[model samples]
Target: MTEGLSLWSLGLAVIVVGALWIYGVNRTMMTVPPEAQKLSPDSNRWSKELMRETYERVKKNPIDIKKHLPPKLDRRYIVVGGSGLVGGDIVAHLLARGQSPEGIRIVDFAPLRRPDILGVASNVDVIKTDITSPNSVKAAFSKPWPASVAGLPLTVYHTAAVIRPGERSLQTYDRVARVNVGGTANVLAGAKEAGADIFIATSSSSVAVKPMKFWKWPLPSLASNYVQVFNEDDFDQPLKAHDEFFGNYARAKAEAERLVCAANQEGFRTGVVRPGNGIFGDVENDVTFGPTLKAGDIVSWTPHVSQNWISSRNVSIAHLQFEAALNPSVRAVPPPCAGRPLLVTDPCPPITFRDFYSTVSTLSVTPVTETYPPPVLMLILAYAIEGWANLIINFPILTKLFGWKEPTGDLAMLQPAVFTVSAYTICDDSRARKSVEEGGIGYTGVTDTLTGFCEQMAVWNARVERGEAGPLKGKGAAAPVVA
Candidate 1:
C-alpha cells in the first residue's frame, strides 16, 4: 500500500509542475507593454515637457528672409540628407548630368564616407549640420553659395530623417518627434529664409498604412483579407498615436508631411514623394564592406510573402523629374506641388520575397526548399521576448547593471504583418507620372532592377573571394559606411 501511495504522489507532482510551466508560457504570450495602451495622444511615449521645450527652440529662431530672396533656379542643389543612400544617388545623378561639383552642397549631421564612390568631387561643399537645432540649420543655410551658381534659384531636397525600430520605445520616441517633426519645421523655415523656391522631400508609404488586425486561427484562417489596395486617397488613414509598434514613427512622419504641405504657398513651391519598400544596389556598404548572396550564388527558395518594392535609383530620378516638371524654365514662376503627396513606385507586379531572393541564386542542378518557423509560433515568441525586455528595462538595478533599454516591439507585430500577411500593398505611381510628362522618371522594369541589384552583389562577392574586400562583420552587417 505504501509503495502504491508513493507512485501516485510522484504522478501528481509531475502533473502540477507541467501545469505551472504551461501557465507561465501562456501568460507571457498574452503580455502587452503597459505603455501601448490606447490609440490616442495620451498614449504618446515621449515626455510632454521635453516636446514643449524643443518646439519653443524651433519657434524662437525663425528663418531669415533677407538673405534668401528671389530664389536662384539654375540647378544649384542643396541636399539635406546628401550622405544617405538615396541622397548619395541624387548627388551621383547630378554629377552624371554634368553639374559642376562646386554647384552642389551637401548638409548632413554626419560626414560623408566613401568619397571615392562620388568621384572624389573636391569642389563639393560638405556642411556638418544638426537639423533638430534651429541654430545649426540656420548656420548651414548661411554659408555662401558658389559665385557661379549664386544667381540661380536653389532646389532644396530635404530627405534627412530618423528611421529605426527602436524609435517606438518611450526612451527614444521624443528624439524622433523632435527631429522628424520639429526638424522639418526648421527645414521649411530655413528653405524659405534661404530663398529656396523649389523643395522636394522624401516620405514613406507607412504614413497611410494601418496596423494589421489579425484573425483567429482555425475559422478565419489567421490571415488578413486583401480587401484594400492603398492609394493616394488613403493618406488620411494613418496609424494612431497609441498604436502598439509603429505608431510613433507613423505619427511623426504625418506631422512632417503636414509641415511640408503647409509651406507650399507663394514664394515656396514644395512637393513630397511617398515611396514603397525601397531596395537597391549599395556599392559603398555592400561592396567595399561585406557581401551577401550575389548573382550565381546557390540559394534555396521558399513560398515567401509578396509586397511592393521600388529601386533607389528610380527614387532619385523621380525627384529631379518632378522638379523639372514643376518649373520648366529656370526663372519661370513654378507651380506648387501641393494638395496631395505623389506616390512613387516601380511599375511592376507584386513580387514575393522568394522571387526577389532567387535573383541572386546560382544555376543549380537541383532545387532546394527553404523553411521558416511557423508564423503562429513566431508571434508567440515575439510576445515572450517583448515581455522579457520590458521586465529588464523596468527594473532600475537590472537596467543600470545590464544597460537594458526598452526594445521596440517592431519584430513582434509589425514585421510579421509586413512579411507574412500583408493586404493589397501596391502604390499607384500613375498620378505623379501624369502630372509630369516624364512618367515617374521613366521607371526601370522590375526584372531589370533586380538584375542590376544582383550584378552589383556579384561584383562585391567576387572582390571578397579575391581578398580585395577585407573581412566583413557578418553576411550583411548594419554599419554606417555611407551615412
Candidate 2:
C-alpha cells in the first residue's frame, strides 16, 4: 500500500510540472497582444525569434546594421526631412531600390511640399508638416489616398534637424528641441495613429559629447567641446543638468534625442541613426558648415581636429534599409532586430582635421592654418553659436539672424557639424559592405574629401539658381588647389 501511495505522489508531481510549463507558455505569449498572435505560428515564431536575435546581436554580436533589419513584409515608406540633402537622398534611394514614389512620402519644415519620385504625387499625394505640432504631422499622414495606393502601413524615416556650426543660442537650442524632440514626438504619435510599422530616426554622433566641468581635466578641449554637445553614454561619471542648455544647440539636441528614446520605449518600433559629416547635394549651403563661415565666408575650423564625415546619400540609404527590414502591419518587427542608434561614419574613414585643412586650403586656395582666425575669434564663434542656437530653439522664426532668411531651403541648418571620432569609435564595415555587395542592400563611398568639398561648392552654386540664394555676386571663382 505504501509503495502504491509513493507512485501516485510522483505522478501528481509530474502532472503539476507539465501544467506549469503550459501556463508559463501561455502567459508569455499573452504578453504579445492577442492581435499579434493571430499570425501563423511559424510566422509568429519567426517574428519573436527575430526580435530576440536583434537585441542579442546588438548587445553581443559585432555591430552589423544590415542584419538587424528584417526582410520587408510591406514596402511603403515615409521620409521626414526629405527636403534636406540627407533626407532627399533617402527618398531617392527608396526609389532606386524599386519602392514606387506612390509608396513614398516626404515631409519637412521647409515651405515647399512635393510628391516623391515615381510621379506618385501626380496620383497619390504629397504632404507638408510641422513636426513640433502633432496636428501638422497627423494632417500630413492623413492626406487622402486613392484605391491605387496600397493600404500597407509604413516605415518612417525621420532625418531632420536645425543645426549649423556657427549658429547657436539658448533660444535656438529650445527651437531645436521643439523641432527635433517635439517634432519627433509628434511624428511618433502620428505613426501610431496611422499604424506605421517601423520608425527610423536619423540621429547624430553628437550624443557622445561629454562635459568638462572637472578640475584640471586631461581632455579639457575634447571634454568642453563635447559638453557643448551631448552624450548617450550610460555612466555615472557626471550628473547632467536636466533643466537647460550648456549652450542652445546641444541642449535642444539632448532633449530631442531623449524624447526619441522615450518614443522607442513607448512601443513604436524605432531606430536612431547618428551620422557625421553628411556630404550630399546641398548640405554645404547655409547648413552643414555654411553657418560656420565668417562674414567673409571663412569656415570656422581647426586644421588639426580629426572628425568623422559620411555621405548624405549613405545616411538616406540607411533609412530605407531600416524601413525594408521591418514587418508591415505588425506593431514591431522581432529578432533580426528593432530600430537602433548607430554612428554612420563612412565605408572608409575620413581625413584628420589637419588633413581636412590641408586639403581645403589647397583646394580653396586659402592658407588654412594661417587663415585660421585668432584664438579669441574661435572662442567668440563658439559662444555665438551657442547663443544663436538658443534663440532658434526658443524662437524658430528667429533664425533669420543667422542668415537663415527663409523658412525653406538651406536656411534651416545654420552651421556645420563637427563630429569628433575617437580612435576606437571608428570600426571596420567590411561585413556591411559584403552584405550590400551581395545585393540585399547598396552603398557607395566618398573616396576623396576634396572632391566631396568641390561637389558641395558646386551644389551651393546651383542653389543660387534655385532662387534660394540671389544671383551669385561673384565670390571666389573656384577654390584654389594648393600645388
Count of clashing pairs, candidate 1: 5
The C-alpha stretches of model 2 lying farther than 4 A from their native spots are: 1-74, 111-124, 164-172, 212-239, 242-246, 265-267, 277-280, 283-296, 299-301, 328-333, 336-339, 353-370, 380-470, 473-483
Task: Provide the lDDT at 53 for model 2.
Answer: 43
TM, every model: 0.71, 0.60
Which parts of model 1 have CA positions greater than 4 angstroms off? 1-73, 166-172, 215-222, 225-228, 236-246, 283-303, 328-336, 363-371, 392-397, 401-424, 437-448, 465-468, 473-483
Clashes of each: 5, 50
Measured on C-alpha atoms, candidate 2 has an lDDT of 0.47
Q: Pairs clashing in candidate 1?
A: 71-153, 72-152, 72-153, 73-152, 73-153
Alpha-carbon error at 401 in model 2, in Å? Answer: 19
The per-residue C-alpha lDDT of model 2 at residue 99 equals 57
For model 2, how many clashes?
50
